[model samples]
Target chain A: MNINEIRNAARRNAGHVRRTPLLTSPFLDEIAGRQVYVKPECLQHTGSFKYRGAHNAISQLTTEQREFGVIAFSSGNHAQGIALAARQNQTPATIVMPSDAPQLKIDNTRALGAEVVLYDRESGDRDAIGAALAEERQLTLIKPFDNEAVIAGQGTIGLELANQAREEGIRNAQVLVPCGGGGLTAGVALALEHDAPDLTVHPVEPTGFDDVARSLHSDRIEANAQRTGSICDAIITPSPGQLTFPIMRRLCGAGIVVPDEDCLRAMAQAFTRLKLVIEPGGAIALAAALFHRHQIKGDAVIVVVSGGNVDAPVFTDALNRFA
Target chain B: MNINEIRNAARRNAGHVRRTPLLTSPFLDEIAGRQVYVKPECLQHTGSFKYRGAHNAISQLTTEQREFGVIAFSSGNHAQGIALAARQNQTPATIVMPSDAPQLKIDNTRALGAEVVLYDRESGDRDAIGAALAEERQLTLIKPFDNEAVIAGQGTIGLELANQAREEGIRNAQVLVPCGGGGLTAGVALALEHDAPDLTVHPVEPTGFDDVARSLHSDRIEANAQRTGSICDAIITPSPGQLTFPIMRRLCGAGIVVPDEDCLRAMAQAFTRLKLVIEPGGAIALAAALFHRHQIKGDAVIVVVSGGNVDAPVFTDALNRFA
Candidate 1:
């Protein structure tokens, strides 16, 4: 909820969440004409920054709540994150997923010691099932982005980015964050705005699902018709959450929309030049900086690569399309 | 070189050599019934452990040698390592690469501010071209391995491994090292043998080019005149270098050979389970452990994932094959 709370949460979850290396790319620097640094969340536990929030939130739960178990509704990174967090906390977690979720994600979630409950999105809503399960079992429902603890946990990444920038001697630079439901962006903006106010914060989203950008433009929480075929499957949220959107609207400077092709190109560039494997959603900020270089300031830029839990076949296919 | 000298060299090059994470793998543990930890060299600069040795060797060059520049002959990670090291040292570098070397590798070397001289391996030897270039340009030839400076530099990985093992409370464990010209294995073995004498060290090689194994068995360097195609491009060296072979023979507790299929499987497992993009050569040690799980010591084990700079098409094909 607050910057200090986020910092404390991050400190508590330090050992659990990987302090993933913030790598500099000589090739990316040449392309952007700026000092480009990548915070690889792909290298994090469960292959995303979602692990940070999930772990931090789960770690701070009441013993009674943890004993009753936790419920999460996600078709991707959040499912795996909650699964892994529950496993680490020695608590049971039930993850509700759409039947059409990527098998890789399902398998990873199950592998991390979470019970998977699947529902068809066309026929039923997974959130309803998750809520029902929580009510029936008196389980604690962990909202992916709307909850205070979740936002605070995600904010830890911003704390890390600010520290990394300071350590790297980057006095003033823009931090690009990818927004799905604005959880990551809200957390990053909250930390940067409080501590490193001089550091500009940019939240990146896909063109089709640029609710954050729309909200910034209209000064209202704008919602679009639920749609899902973006290359960046992880950040395909139809709209920002009530809790996260307000924080993002206040703390974020501006939002940028990157094309699907830009996401593919950035994924390719990450694989080849940065020697990193980033999922499309994880690479949206990188894509923006690469293709939308004109929008960025020619100073030190830190891009938070949100996650890397991409299915191998899907990742290779993306690379092929870009190639 | 003595262990103390190599340790000092590693300490000197610590700032340049990334302290790659010793990643834990519960999946690997479940499969092998032994706690499996991976020392991720794939995440290192230049995408391999060669960077440590190359940078160590180049940085220690005398003022006269630095002015004259450096020359290296390799078609893989070593070329990129030397090129980047020389460039960072602000010294000119002429890399003599095979004409058929991966274009990506060539491009990366050139990008690092190295002048590449392509030579036809069929018509002439790469080492001969490198020798000529060094003589013509008055540059020092930085051998990929088989040199005291290079071995000392490569030993840094071993030092890091020791620290990682200590941090993880792994007092005694079996450590697997991928062997090519035996430079890496020799360095790692020397460091481990000296620092952690309780640790067991195993050298793994391709079934086709088990030069270190053969040399260790014969108690002398053995050249395999029969050149066979190895799926692992990085470890296709037909024979072990004289300098490295002796050290490997003295230090390695055992040697093992893994098939191409095992390497491919290991690479797939690494990509999917570990969320890492390790090249075939980098996955051989993992392959040896996974395929030879029955033979390895029934204790905690560490696998040195050597490098991750596979050609795009080849890597795609490998992923497809395993998929």
Candidate 2:
């Protein structure tokens, strides 16, 4: 997606996606020894940044596509995003969710007026089921992070962050973003690079699934089918997507890998000190900053907290283990 | 304090206190059949509305008084609020905390550069120790409630809520505020009554310790010395404060009582649906709206979530009980 197109998408969806606040923290700054601003998407609708993508994608659909409805395969924030977006657009939506997924998510998606089809992750094929349903019903398939509209939609967060920071008298600063399939990070990097080329953008990845870091070093896409289930479940993707990696490589500086324990510790700190309920994935970028991942130094920095959809038990366990 | 004085204090402390967002929930609206807006003071600095009163009290201190330092006795959000506000004002602060208070709170107060003096709740004389310290050190005592400056500071939330509702095109809405010593409820009620007299204000009290509610009905302060800690630790005050009860009686329309179990259920629902970390006391008004008192029918109704400084284990247990 072009930078101008992404900016227009951001403008188009401004009313739909929350203009999530950029909050400054003296406590976080005292720890990092720099001024820190956080773009809190954890407080976004559906409790994640995925709402922007889903809302933007649904808005861009043709009348025929809207009439036929939409389908997607996701067991988490993306599912809720699609469900809420479709509900707002008065379109029918079908979501294929793994049976073992958290019941809170399933209930939320269903509550948003979406039809949820459950498939056992151990034995059932979610993608195949979703694809079949879409084809059989002539519904449009809205890919979670791979489509151009989705990328452009996610890029709006970066644009807003840059503008907000500039308005806050931060002419130049480092921006940190957590990476899953690299869609959010790539979109943000592209937007920031085009709008504020002087600003440095850093991608933070979970340690066990640091495929993006490895890919940057090897100059190619790297995949890891195994070794999932990091503490940061929200961003535990097996590989970086083909479209996202190239964009990230062209726009971002370097990727940083942070341990799962650090993410949990950051999560607890955020909850206790900042009063923000952040999921492990959303805390990773702040964790990287807290642990000092890069050799570079700055007077100001921004961390993108991407989501807050953590199961109560899982969140408690993480807090107990780290706090 | 007069309503005009309280309004002036609120204006003076505007930058210091977060004009916390008033969030609308379609899901909550669907469930209650009324428009629900949540004023999330749970996201305030120090995780509570105590910061507002603390800031206001400290700002009014004389130069000599500030030099002698400030002293407060509490086992909850009050300690953190006093410590942070004192630090910001460049004054020394001494806090007397119960031995059984959460370690996180103790650490946070200490980190904010306050001298935390621990006393045994079972054996040690809290009031005597506090008085001795104040007299010996010549420190200014900042009471948690029962003070005009503090009550005025807490009233800022109401001012912001009224402004926020106006921005959202909502006029003459009903608002519910949880009452402990009645500082928050009284301050908010005074502000709302002054700015928008047509608006109705409801104060929610815990079922077992409904001293404020009883006092409002009887036109006199009441006591329940035997009552303590069934749940909602933040609002377990033994009696209503003399400074706040009269204001509540004058401005508040009615008082609503909510059960402990209902508070837990509201906390769980807030986590699952709105993705907010609200303490038991913070969820009381919402609990009242959801279960106990459903007679509040309006085009728009706002619930003030007072704080989010919950102990992790207690939070986990509450979630499990409700979920």
Candidate 3:
């Protein structure tokens, strides 16, 4: 994807999306030992930046394709994003999700006007279920991060933040983004490369699921040994997407890996300092910015808190432990 | 304070203050049964709207007075606001706080570069101590809500949100503001009277501390019987300010009083739906918008969540019971 595509997507997504605020606090700056700017996509529609991709992708569809509707397979932020975006576009949406996914997610997707089809995740193949459903309903399958339109949509954040950085008088900095399938990281890296050449992008991942980091290190695609049961479930893909890895490999700096505990602490810090409720997966990039300060350069750092679709118990636990 | 004063405060606050975003969600709209717009002053500097007034008041001080420094007596949001604003203007601030105040507030004020003077709440007279200290140092005393410049500063929110509401296509609506000493409510009421005439302003208070409501009803100033023991400490003032009450009496609609439980529930709801951390006092306006819809008159309602500096245990309790 190019700047033109991101610009086009931004134009299409204009009124329907929120240009979420860039947040900062002196308390956070002291903790990170530098100026820390936070791009809280959790404040975005559907409480995640995934809505940017979902909305853009839906907008990119042909009238006939949109009339036929769209299908996606997700049990978390992506599901809600697609559901809400499709509803806003007046396009029917069907989300194939794991039966074991949190009831809150399932209920929220349904509430957003999407038909949720749940399959057994342990034994059932989500791809097959989504494919069969798509074929039966003549629906276009929307990949969360693998598609070009979605990546371009996510790149809009890059374009917005580059200007915001300049407004804040930040000349050079590293931007840490949570790495799931590398869609957000690659998109941000590419946009920053074109707009703010002095600013570098880094993908931050959890220790056990650092596939994007390993892939960049080895100069090839890498897969995680284990996927399920990660605290950061929103970012536990098997590996980096085929479309996203190459852009990230070229444009991104070395990846930053943080532990789950640090992610929890970051959640508490977001609550205490920013008054934001961030889920564990969404807090990892912030964790990297605050905890992995030794690996970073520049006097300022920007972290993209990717999402905030977390349960109360999980959030309270974080606050209790750290706040 | 008049429109001219608010306009001047807005100009003074242009660069240093954040014009915090107006947030809304379908979920909140569904709960309120109307389009609900939230002005999260909880996201403001010092995690409250108090910063606006503090900065404006400090800036209003004469160069000689500013050089001599400023002083205030507050143990909560106001203390931190004054501390930060004073530091930003390179003016020394001395805050006389009750020794029994939460350690977090005291520490936060001190961390922001203010000198903390602790006094006993039970026996020691805070006014006497503050007056003595001010007399000794020749420091200008900044009242929390009674000062003309401070009220004008708070009025800036009304000016900002008036334009924001019109942009959202809201021609007529009610603005529910958390009422402490009525500074925010009176300021916003005055500003909206000029800028957004169709939008009425209402003061929201907790049940026991409905002094503003009683005073508005009686057409005379009234004081609360209870002095302490409130879940919403931020808004536990005995009565409205002499200056602010007159303006509130003229411009404000009937005051809306919510029970402490509803405030707690609103806090949990803000956390769950808005991904925002709101203190009990700040959540009262939102609670009125959701639970007291019958008392309101409009197809849309705007609520200002004024602060978010709750302790962890209290927040966790709200989550545990309601979330």
Candidate 4:
């Protein structure tokens, strides 16, 4: 989809989704050696930007589809997002989540009135379980990052960034977005291309799960050998999406990769300097901006903190280890 | 100070300080049994709303006073606020802090270009130390919350709440503010009285250090029996300020007291649900709204999370214990 479709999606989700704050910190600027603006999507509804896509996709369902209900498969954040979105639209939802996923996320998703189906991360096939369940119940399957409506929904954040930048009189900026399947990156790139061409978008990923970065380097989709071991569990998809990769390849800049240690440091910095609690996956973009400052082309850099759904033990460990 | 003074302070601080977002959570709403909007001043410059008062007070200093420099005494957030504000105004700052204050706060204050003199909280008088330093150096003493300019500066947050409420079409609201010396509560109450008379503001304090609450109940200044033991170091003042107490008595609703355990829970909730890091003192207002919902008056409640400058270990303990 194009920017116009994203704008339409924005209109549809205007009051339904949160317009999270774009924050800045002098301490962060000092470390980066340049101006840095943080788009904290971690502060969005359900504590992640996934709510935007989930709300947009669920809200556009036909009456009959709503009656039949919807199904989604996710490790954590997307499940919570879709559960809350479906509940708001009065549509029943079933989420397939890894049994080993953070307990907080699973409890939260279930609390939002969604039926949860658990699967083993190493041995169970979540897609197969979801597909069979959807068929049995006549439920519509909502793919996390591959659907047009969902991409358009995530693109709305790009529109907000452009407007906020214009309001601040920033003529040019480099935006670093955490990437798993390239859906958020591609959507933002397209929106920025249409609304603020001067601002360039770059995808940021964990060092081991650098599928998006490798794909951009080779000019095609790529896959990661392993995904279950990364500290950044949220953005550890096995590969780039079929639809999202092409759009990202066309409109996005070269991608960046950050190690888990840098992500922990970024999370600690966000807590101390920005008074923000950012999960590991959500901090990859900020890590890239801080440690890879030399690669940035513009004076101003915007880092999108994508989600904050980490377990308590993980967050405490990050703070202690980094400190 | 009046609403016009607050408006002027807001204009003065327009570009200097961040206009922190007013966020909402459905989980929080469920707990409060009403719609709750959070004004997270924890995201403010220097990790607290003290920066507004410090900036306004320092900015209004006379040329001679600016040339000589400024002095203040505090254990944490206020010291950093004054240091940053004075540096921004090109004025040197000397801060008298407790010897046992958090190492993080002391380091942050010094990093901002302030000379820190540590006094033993149990054996030394910080006020005398500050007075002697001001006398020797001819430094202007910027009181943390007692001065008119400082109170007016803090009142700017009230103006923002009124405007934000109007934008959201909320005609009436109950505002909960974490109180130390009652400056924030008094200032906000006065501003709301003039701008949005329908909105009632209440002071929330830690149970052991409920000086403002006791003073409000007695209609006079009352001191806490102990001064230095509360976990909420940012707001452990012994008594309500002479100037701030009168204003709170005149305009504010009855004060609320929350236990330290409740504050810990609030901090964890903020981290998990709002993706915001809030200190123990900063979480008291939110704790009041969550645990003391029946005390709130209107259908819409606004909780002002006043600061976020706790040490790493303290924050980790809160998250772990609460989780």
Winner on lDDT between 1 and 2 is 1
Give one digit per residue, the lDDT tens place, for model 4 in B31-115: 8889989999988889899998899889988999999999998887889989999999999999999988888889999999999
**What's model 3's lDDT at A37?**
96
Better of 2 and 3 by lDDT: 3
Query: What is the C-alpha lDDT profile of model 1 across B121-231, one tens digit per residue?
Result: 567677777777778789898888888889888888888888878877896788898888888888888898888777778888888788778888889888765444676
* DockQ agreement of candidate 3 with the native complex: 0.84
lDDT of 3 at B16: 78
Report the candidate with higher DockQ, 3 versus 4.
3
Candidate 2 reaches a DockQ of 0.49
Candidate 4 Cα deviation (angstroms), residue A17: 1.5
Residue range A1-323, candidate 2, lDDT tens digits: 67987887787787678777777656778877787777878788888899898998998888889999999877677888899999999899999887766676788889889999998766787778987898899989887777888888889988988788777778678888988888788888888888877777888888778888888878898976554467676677767887888888888777888988888888876766676778888899988877773443688888999988777887787778865
Clashing pairs in 4: none
How well does candidate 1 score on lDDT at residue A319? Answer: 68
Q: Tell me the docking grade of candidate 4.
A: high
The first chain of model 2 has a TM-score of 0.94
**B16 Cα displacement, candidate 3 (Å):** 1.1
TM-score of 4: 0.97
Candidate 2 ranges beyond 4 A from true positions: A23-36, A118-128, A194-198, A292-296, B1-7, B30-33, B119-126, B293-295
What lDDT is obtained when candidate 1 is compared to the true structure? 0.83
Q: Which candidate leads in DockQ?
A: 3
